[model samples]
Target: MRNLLILGAMAFCLCVHVCSDTQSGPQGDTTLPEEDGVLQLKQEHFKRALRKYKQLLVHFCKLHSDLSFKDAAEALMGSEVKLGVVDVTQEKDLVKELNGTSYPMVRLYISGDIHNPVPCPGVKTVLSDRISYFCTNLHRLSHLCFFVQELTNAYSQVFHAAAVDLPDISFALTQNEEVSRKYRLSQDVVLLLRKKLDCRKHFKTSQILSSPVLNHALLFVNKSSADFEEISSAFSSAAENFRMKILFVLVNVAESRNGRLMEYFRVRDFEAPLIRLVNLTDHVTYHLPSDTLNVEVIQEFCQSYLDGKAKPKMQSEPIPEGWDQKPVKELVGMNLEQVAFNPDKTVFVLFYLPYSKASRTLFPLWEELAEAFRQREDVVIARIDASANDINLSTQGAYPSLCLFPALYTERSHIYIWRKKYLKTEN
Candidate 1:
């Protein structure tokens, strides 16, 4: 019911909000021409987001004016679409109102008080500009707030929709009480909020298949008796269209009610991973039994999943820095190609860009690897440029070809290489 509807609405809104043009009003009259130009530039920047940017700015010059804000608030009163317009006139207001230090800040606050807006920090600038860039840099606290807001908003709508009684929903900054005194959330409310936000959503039909990174239930299962093939096709189409990772979890009656999907693609039986649960097995042991077959089981399970250690599938491949070591066959252009590799020796290759900021930031990482294996004779590191390669490597293709040979060899020399890991690492 509500869960299904909220699911549809969340997906529809998120997709539309990301893909479609945002509601940008004309730059109203301003005192300074610079402000006017900046507004226009900001609009252009937001319009150019190539799917990486989730939060886009919708300039509401009218929003800043008292009369305009009041008018917009009235218009939004009966409308289904919600808008959050943040005003940053004073430094104290910026800190207290937005819980942030950033300026010219705009946040999307769904179903919350406008005065107490939660930060949404992953929002990036579509273009480079000094002022806009300065206003968008996020602090660590604000980043956590953004993630928590997103996580809780999802929970408040779907899994917690049918709660007979609403539990307190808040969050704390630290685990220990004596650590510090900043940004601490109410304990009881935080506990419930944490639980609801942690459990993943399940749907009966495989209509949409996007998975949530955090614990929360989302309805992707189609309830209508659609054909199994059609449902699978719908899910695949949705996933492909949205460019998201989605999967289906089938619940089993026997064994653990908590089933989790493993890296190996198997859904193993586990305890339920939710906040509160009513145990069919027990009625008297009510001190919030830790192992009770209630919502807490789901919570514990999700916590475990989030904290679980990952098992390495293959050996580590660390690529070396500075370019190819030896002169060899020509194929260099703007495409990527596998240079060489060996099976016996430890091998790693890094794809680098000469002029890119991202590459420059990664130079230190290469230096660290070089130092670690500088004296060691067992490991081999290689570097390639994505911009200056011989054969044209597909942007959709994988990267950093790593080859391991049977014996030690000179730089750029290799006996053989595993083709799969080399390709995937490029991305």
Candidate 2:
């Protein structure tokens, strides 16, 4: 079933195509024409569009198998926003220049500045949801508050409130006709207030355990629907109050579907109505007190967890086989930070396509470098298969690209020193 789902998703991605109106250019030149809707961006028009629009959302994807790109473009179609898509396969130079080795990468360019772009959250199927939420909440939170009065006056008041930082809230007036029609707004005008931090109540094993977001995950493990409902209600109330400070997740241990996670968390058969707070960053767990669950107790639990008073029970995962035995450390999404950002050591990472001739050709060079640096305590060498790792290699400019990363302990922040010496060789 899992394999079938994976294949289905792959099929969906394979069907994505460049817009029909997209114009092709010479070998190195890609042209992007001015279009009102989603602009099919090429190398030539990428930077120009960023400079023209105050807020631009660019989707870097291949011509095929890019379902996320299509979904994001469709969701933001009617909004007064500039949306663009880049076919990474067609413009390899541009992709390399931007360090965009990951498929279906989304970036937000604000105020024509290209040096630092905010990465769009969520991946694969959830891309559209995250993009919609971000678009709705960009700059400040937006709410669709209805007010039956002069439209201009309401907008002015909201603008003034946002400008003066009053009410500790930001506001925007969306008078776009298309947006109004899409949302079915019958009134002449409405105030859009920002929403509170959107929290995930029901979590799957994949999302909760793998997400990089650092938060105290309060999991309510219950069997009965009545117990689940009561605890969920209390959790929702507390979650809104704490909003963004913690994550509340509900797990039905009774369901066979969640059996694996239950076992992983070590929830005994008798511990159905139990609650566990997990801190993924530190790999710590805290069990709830034996007393009945309530809003007050849950709040106290969160407060105590935040205050670092709760005793931490360690959670461990068996290291992958041959992890520490490799000379060129294989980089994955989970271990990227632990290796790349080591405070005591400088890391030299090679980003390459595993099967490519160029990558194979450079393997010996990297191995030799790793061997030379093996005894150096302050320096580490690593290599990442660009195809296997979906992480953003922000400084990588080409396949088999070498990037020297400074130690985190250095006063200067992480900087990528790109090496083009090896890339000059023919594949």
The local distance difference test score of each candidate is 0.33, 0.62
**Deviating ranges (above 4 Å) for candidate 2:** 1-52, 57-81, 87-148, 152-213, 254-260, 268-270, 314-427
Q: State the lDDT of candidate 2 residue by residue for 126-178, as single tens digits.
A: 23443234323212124553333344575555554443222223333444555
Taking all chains together, each candidate's TM-score versus the true structure is 0.21, 0.41
Query: Among these predicted structures, which one has the highest TM-score?
Result: 2
Q: Which digits, one per residue and each the tens of the lDDT, describe model 1 over residues 164-248?
A: 1111222222233332124454332232222212122444322222234212222122233333344334333332222212132
lDDT of 1 at 128: 27
lDDT of 2: 0.62
TM-score of predicted structure 1: 0.21
Residue 360 in candidate 2, Cα distance off native in Å: 32
Model 2 TM-score is 0.41
lDDT of 1: 0.33
